[model samples]
Structures are given as structure tokens and as C-alpha cells.
Target: MSVADAVAPPRIRCLAVDDEPLALGMVCAFIEQTPFLELVGQHDSAVAALQAVHAQPAIELLFLDIKMPGLSGLELARVLQNGPRVIFTTAFNHYALEGYKVDALDYLLKPFGYEEFLRAALKARAYFALLAGGAAPAPVPPAAPEEDHIYLKVEYQLVRVTLADIVYVEGLKDYVKVHLASAARPLLVLTSLRRLGEKLPSRHFLRIHRSYIVGLGHVQAVARGTVQLRGQTLPVSEGYREAFDQFFNRWK
Candidate 1:
């Protein structure tokens, strides 16, 4: 393998186990996109994956699915001795936290987006590197002020906007539109308001409505349930108004 291939995060010599052929293809495609990963082989059955891993000790990673015909992914993982690092791919959210018992690097939910997959891959890379004499990755730095930001890749452009700059965010089904300061148009993203909410400073951003988050710093006006910011009127919903009130009162 070339130097580039040797060092790419995905090139860790992978074996993917999934009963669904389409799922297997999608995982393989993702692995192909990364320079560091290589598909040593794939298996539709957990038993087959187990046999291959035992036969081929050099396979360093397993992207095994949790729900499979015959032996379950967890059962297969348990039977193997001196097995490769595992990254469980599953649809069940309940199984996510439980995967750590078998020493899984990460647990990926089914129908995962590229970004979500990348996040899990990040965990796997750090775990492998640390095992190979690399120091443990540093704890995430505390988010302060403008530290909470998102990179919007749109139309071949990357726009960096802090959570503080947002006047409000409106969710449109699977997408969200962020109204920020000094932007002519809202920063549209293929994400949820809930996801963006996690990246924001809780003290500053309030989910006054199911689809809206008004930045505390940008609250231009408030009268009853109505919130006015940047000449835009937002609502403090019945369910969330108390949350806003508690936060707003504490800030005062």
C-alpha cells in the first residue's frame, strides 16, 4: 500500500458484516472515500464474519451490524479471541450504550449520514492511534462564547457562523434555516434545530418555539408571547415560555 493509503483512517483493514447487501455497499463506499481504510472482505452473516476474523488475524477493524441472521453481532464478538477492534453498526438506539461491554470503539446507528459517520470514525481513529503509542486524545475544550460554531458547506462555499450571531433558527422538516447577524439570507443547512441547539450556549439560546431558537444576546424586544429581534417577530410558545422566563429572569 502507498504511504497515503497506509495512513488514511479508513485503511485499517476492515471487515463489514451486515445481512443487507445495500447496507454493506454503503459502508464499503464510505470506506473507499477515505484513503486510510481498505475492505479486506465483507460478510452477510455474523457467523461468516467470525470465521474470517479467526482465520485472518490481520483484519484490524470490524464494522459489524448488530441485528443479523444466525449469530448476533454481539454474540460473534464475544466468541472471538484476540479479535480486531469493533465498530458496531446498528439500527437500535438502545444497543448503542451497551456496545462498550464488548470493547467497541463506536456504535453507529443505521441510516447514518456522512457527517455522523465521520464523527464515529473520529473516535475509532483516536482509539487506534492511542493503542499504537500515540497519546490519548485531549478532552474537548470547554466551549465559551463564540467557540460554539458550525461550518456550513453550501454551493462550494464554507460559511462559519457562531451560535451567538443567530437571531433565530427555523426548522423546515429535515432542514433548518439560521437567521444570523449581517447575513442577507438565512444560512440553510441539512440539519435539525435539535442538533444546532446542542452546539449553542444554553444560557444564550432559548428554544422558545419547537422550530425557533432566539439568541439571548439578540433579543431586541419581548411583549407577552412575542419576541422581536432584528425587526423580526418570534414567539415564546406556551410550553417553552416558562423555560425562557426562567433563563431570562436569571440573566437580569
Candidate 2:
């Protein structure tokens, strides 16, 4: 082998497919900009992309759009099955849950910048790397019994809060108010509710609405459309009702 060939780093071969020319071009551009991703083909139709993937078994990743003419990206993905890893790109947020059901590596919402695209690409790279090493990707672990606290930023200082002491969290636009069982006033922190929810242990916390996340341990009652925690009633919106019911039923 040549010295250059021996020294060159490996890259993940990728394909970009979207019904729109502009969206396809943007995906291709992002792929080209990434050092570890090598774009092999860019197609404006799922049929063409399907052909390309079949012809080239070396392609390890696909940047696919979910909604396409004739053959949709979701249909193509189902056909491909275990053929190649996929990172779905689309404008609609409602497709996210379905995309995950099909084992998509990541979902990039439309008008996403390079940062979001790169984040998804890197996830694919890591999955490939794990496969190359002959090891299965690790599953997310459940919350440990010993892990019972988290630190939150309040104004200029970080205050440590015991996990069991939290009653609920209220989201206010860009900030969240953390209500504690022992405190008279909730602590206001400058962070999104979604972001903060990710930090809390999933076993203890559940998001019931876009504006609220409640501690399961602190919940006193559950009604038709609301959750009661420490005498405070919080509505469980339609979007989260199914998930909340599933979990609630499991404990009964």
C-alpha cells in the first residue's frame, strides 16, 4: 500500500436525499464540510437514492428527508431496514416519534444550522466507530439509587438541591422556576424546561406539559386532566397524556 493510503484516516461514506433541491444541497454541503463524512451521492428523489444505496454497499450513513414524492423517506428507511444508519432531516416536529420508532440516529428540524447538522452527523460517526470496534452501542442506564441530588444555578451562585425535596418545576419562556418542598419561594433559574428536564432523573421526574415538570414522588393525586402535587393542581396536556397514563398505569 502507498504511504499516503496507509496514513489516511477512515471516513463514513454518506448519501443525502431530499425531494427539494435546496434542502438536498444544504445536506450535501454540510456533509462535505464535515471531515469524517464523505458524501458519495446526493439525490432529489427517494427512488434515486434507494438505487444509489443498493448499488453502493459501502455507504454507511444516510441524510434523508422524511417526506418525499412517490417513495417517502420513511418508506425507504423501512425497506432498507438494517442496511445503513439514518439521520432524518425534516421541517415537521410531529414526525420525530415515528422516526425514532424506525431507529433513526437523529432528527434534524428544518432551518437547522451546521451546529445541529454536525451534532447528528457526529452521532452517526460514533455509532459506526462502535461497530468498527466490534462492540454494541451501550444502552442508557436507569437512575442509580445513590444519585439523589443536582446543582442548579440561581443568580450568581450554584445551589445544590436534594432530588427528593423538589415538588415541581414551572417553565416561564426561557427560564424555569424550581419549586422545593422545604422552601417558601421557588428558585428561578435561567434555562429551558426541556433542557432542565433532561438533567433530572427520569424515574423521579415527569413532564406533564410544555410549562411544567412534576416530581413523581411528590404527586398526591391524579384526575381526568390534571396532576395534584402538594395541593397545587397542574394540567396534563393532550400531547403528554398518553405517556403519563402509561407510566401511571404501570404503578397500579
Candidate 3:
């Protein structure tokens, strides 16, 4: 199925909450610039976000941090009077169980790049569309199933890019940095961090942080605090720790 066919809905309302001001700002900024998304408000603390939720009932999506100084994001979610759809953000992987318990729309690791963010957003959009009855059933595979790929808009041209050729993606303000084996420099695409991820294969990609995605094969080594791939060093977010272990253990 084509990417547009996979994502038929037009728009979604979103909010972001994180203890770190930079992280919160980043999420809010991204939401504001996205075509299919609206930035309802931003919170540096879960407590504050809760208050906003009460005042503004239009918040349909939440980009939350699992860890916060005063009240943890997960705890805040538990006490919300009328909660919006949650997309939990964290620096550690240990909270995956708790996050899933709440059926959070998506879980994001800290320092996640835009493409990774887009992937989570797409999943959230899909869920909301189904819940709202605004989406149609998945198109049946053609008589002969074909390999999946994505069409990316580069400047004025829509380029066909193979999913497997992707090594990693980075989020630049108002743009996405896409890395490919053939290109010397990563290509920048104008798209939401979460939106680009919708076109990628879930099994092959994982958001270890808010700003980076390490291809399973391209990953050369991973040690405490950092991962080495294609001669670049990538930091690991604390929230993804549990998920990282799970990922490494499966392959080893």
C-alpha cells in the first residue's frame, strides 16, 4: 500500500511534557511545525501538563517523559481526570512494562531524532483514527505481495527510497537528516520527525533516543552511554536502557 493509503487521517492535536526544558521545547516545536499535528501546549512538568489538560480539553495526544522531578510522567498519567492519548517519552527502557500497562500510544527514548519521532506519531495517528472511526480498513495485499518501500519528497521531486538503505536519521529544526549508503552527506527532508517514521519498517528500526536511530546491522559496537556506528558516536537515552538490552539480547 502507498504511504498516503496507510495514513488517511488529516490532523491530530498534541501536547508535550518533559522535565528538561530543551526536550520539552523540541517536542513542542516539532508539533507546531508538523502538517498533520497541532501543538496544544507545552509542559516542563507533568503536574503542569495536568493543569493544562483540565483548562484545555482539546489535547488529544500527549508526548510525555517517563521521568520527571516532582511527579513522574507515568504517575501523572494515572491521575489525569480526562487523559488524552499518550506517547510516553523517557531516557530509560525499564519503564516499558509500565508504559504498555497504560497502553500508551508510543514510547520514545530521549534524544530521539525526527524520523524516529515520526514513526511513533504515525502509530498514534493510526490508533486514534481507528478509535474515532475516521480510518478505513487496511488494504489487502495485491495478488503478489511486494517488498515495502517509501516515497520521500526532496525539494520539488518525490524520490523513491528503499527502506533497507537507511542507516540512521537525525532531526534538524524544521527538517529531517536522512542517511543513506549511497549518499556522502545525509539528505535533509522537510517533514515532521514523527511523520517520516510512518514510512519505515517497525521491526528494523527502534527509537533508542529522540534524535538518533542505529541500524541493527550498521551498529558496530555499543558500550555504556554511547553506541558506535559508521564511525559516529551516538548517546543512549536512559528510558531506552531496558529496550536496548532486549534488543541486544535477541541478536546475541
Candidate 4:
């Protein structure tokens, strides 16, 4: 075999579950087109998927739907022990936060085309490749932030707040609540965690979870891969752990 062929891992065994027939078909089509993925089966319900996983323990990846009739995909994921790694495909963006809580590999917002599907699929492939080879991917290096203050819209008003005043940020669907050291209540604004992450000074802030971004200056402690703020404890996911660790090590 050629060097590339020799080094390439075997095709990842996968299954798909979605209540929507068209959406499920798209997932199946994506798997079929991807040379590195092998679609073992596709089901219309989480219940069927449970049986499939039980029968075929070799399923390494699952394209699951979050909203199903009986057993929701999230419910199935919660109950299944040692189930395949999940990549949730859903029409609702609100479930993005919940998906990470269950440690999903990735979340694909519905009406997502092949390109978006391929991106999520690629992440799963890399994750499985690392698991099979006993190698972890390098963590992304954190960048220095130069901005001191950020502005946000709250109740039809633009509020300017200093970066040092921020304790942390909490994401809820399309909106984020900015907790500050000076304010009694968090500032609520309609924006995504991803967008806020980019706007914030990366050096002083870290996205510790899918739903949380914490100011490094405000972090009192980190225990068990979780960041302890003044009153809240935020989880640091495996994907963001490396960067957070590197940042913490430098600060300490």
C-alpha cells in the first residue's frame, strides 16, 4: 500500500438517527459521499438507534437527531452507556448548548448543507483517529487581547463596560448574559457565544464551555477541569481544555 493508504485508519463505522425523513436522508447522503465514513445503518427514531448500537457495538460515530417522537436523541444519549460518539443534527439552535452538556462531538443546525455536514463529520473522524491511535490533538494556542472595553446592547441601549469588570459570560440560545463585578444583575444581550468569544480579549477571557466564557482575572480556582468563578462553576470541555490549561499555566 502507498504511504498515505498505509497510515490512514480504517473507515469509521457510523449510524444516523433523525425523525425527519429528508434530514435523515441528507445525513445518510453525506456519509455515503465521505470516503472515510462507513454508514452501517440509519434509523428514524432514537429507540431504533438504541437497538442498533446494542447489536452493532462497532459503531464509532452517530449522527443523531435531538428532537424525536418518543425517546429524544438527547435522552437516548444520556441513557446509553458507552454509546458511539454523537454529532447532533437538529433544526433548533437552542439545543446547541444542551448538546455540549452531553459531550456531543459537534452540533449541526438544520437546513445545513453538505459542506457544513462534512465539517462536523471531519471533526468526528479526527476524534476517532486519535482514540484509535492513542494520540491527542494539539490544543489551540490562546491569543493576547488588546481591547479594554466592550459594548453591548441591552433594552435598546448601548452599554460600554470595561473588560476588567467582566466576571464571565453565560450563553442561552442566541443570547448571552454578561456578569460583571460592578453590577448587581448580569447584562442580557442577544448575541451568540461564538461571536462574543471573538470580540472579547482572548488573553483575559477563555471559552471554558459551550455555554460559558470566563475572565481569567476573575477565576478563583480550577478544579476537576472546571473553572470556579465568584459564585458559579463552569465546565471546561475536552476540546477547550488544552488551551485553557496552557493559559492557566502561564498565568500561574
**Candidate with best lDDT:** 2
Global lDDT scores for all candidate models: 0.74, 0.82, 0.73, 0.81
Candidate 4 lDDT, 31-72, residue by residue in tens: 989998999999999999999999999898899999899999
Which candidate would rank higher by lDDT, 3 or 4?
A: 4
| TM-score of candidate 4 against the unseen true structure | 0.54
Q: How high a TM-score does candidate 1 get? A: 0.51
Backbone clashes in model 1, listed as residue pairs: 8-36, 10-36, 10-37, 11-36, 11-37
Cand. 3 TM to true fold: 0.51
Give per-residue lDDT, candidate 1, residue 51.
86
Q: Considering only N, C-alpha and C atoms within 3 Å, which residue pairs clash in candidate 4?
A: none
TM-score versus the correct structure, for each prediction: 0.51, 0.51, 0.51, 0.54
User: 185, model 3: CA deviation in Å?
Assistant: 35
Measured on C-alpha atoms, candidate 2 has an lDDT of 0.82
Candidate 3 lDDT by residue in tens digits, 63-156 = 9998788889889778762579799877566798999888787787654556667777777776777887876445333334334457888899
In Å, residue 195's CA in model 4 sits off its true spot by: 27
Give the runs in model 2 whose Cα sits over 4 Å from its true position.
1-9, 134-252
Q: Arrange candidates by lDDT, descending.
A: 2, 4, 1, 3
For all candidates, what are the clash counts? Answer: 5, 0, 24, 0
